[model samples]
Target: MFRVTRLAVPVLALIMAADPAVAQDPPLCAASSDTARTAAEVIAAVAEHQCPPGSRLRAAMTVAGQAVVLQRSGICAPESVRTMTIRPTPDTRALDTRALGFTCILATR
Candidate 1:
């Protein structure tokens, strides 16, 4: 029984990690309607805002003349990064992330 329990623990952990449904949800942030003019401003605003315990900061912004569509997460971290996605044309949609688990704080500039 002892040997079986030890093996089961690792197997369960692996299963949980592999399955999105079984995996823990990413932390959620409070919704905000604040807008920032630049990416730097957005980063700074997110950094300054405090997240509740166990939650993290996230922001989505549209900058004028910025060609790439960027999605940024983990905004509260000191070294947050942005992932770029190239669309056929610039995405001019208002930043709305409620359906993506958390509502993004900052939207279009």
Candidate 2:
């Protein structure tokens, strides 16, 4: 009886550990919107502003049905491009205007 009890306990433990419903969700942001804004266009847009020389501008963009966070790093005058990286928050479900970097603009749909 003792041996039987130990064997049954192990079997019960194995059965309890077989749950398969736990799953993970996919990332909210995919590679689809990475190309929405080219580096050159961002630089040109910044240059058109009336800020001081060598100053930069922060622009917000809506992408792929979400409000993505955008940050402009530096100016690349020769290449007509500005280094910008987008940060998509977890709850960016709307296309409303939010502060992106230093400027607030509506994201593209």
Candidate 3:
């Protein structure tokens, strides 16, 4: 018979968390913008940056007051999908790559 103790639960959790597969970083996203005003402009900012040709902006949403846009390129290998945030300025909006800094996200596929 096996008995599970309270301490064992946390230890097991820590061990599981340390697993490479689970702990690995997610896919990264990047984009940049010069000047933007409307949401459409913000979304387009990514395409202007480093997005592959024929890639399109799939979705745009505001989370916790932050605007995020997702870009996916069907033509690109690995079918990479990326997302970037559009920050509001006093005048127009801008996508700041420095803010994200190779930030990773779960595969959008």
| Stretches of model 3 off by over 4 angstroms after superposition | 24-109
TM-score of each: 0.32, 0.24, 0.27
Q: Quantify all predictions' global Cα lDDT against the true fold.
A: 0.41, 0.37, 0.41
lDDT of 3 by residue, 1-109 (tens): 9999999999999999989877754323344332323345544554455554433333334341233223232222234444455455555334432222112222323
Candidate 2 segments exceeding 4 Å error: 1-36, 57-86, 90-109
Tens digit of per-residue lDDT, candidate 2, span 1-109: 3456657888977776675444332222211233234435454554454234333234443342222223333332233223344555555535433332222222222
lDDT of each residue in 42-93, candidate 1, tens digit only = 4455446644434543444454332122234334332333333323223334
Name the candidate that leads on TM-score. 1
Position 2, candidate 1: lDDT: 44
Off by over 4 Å in 1: 1-21, 30-37, 52-57, 64-109
Ranking by TM-score: 1, 3, 2
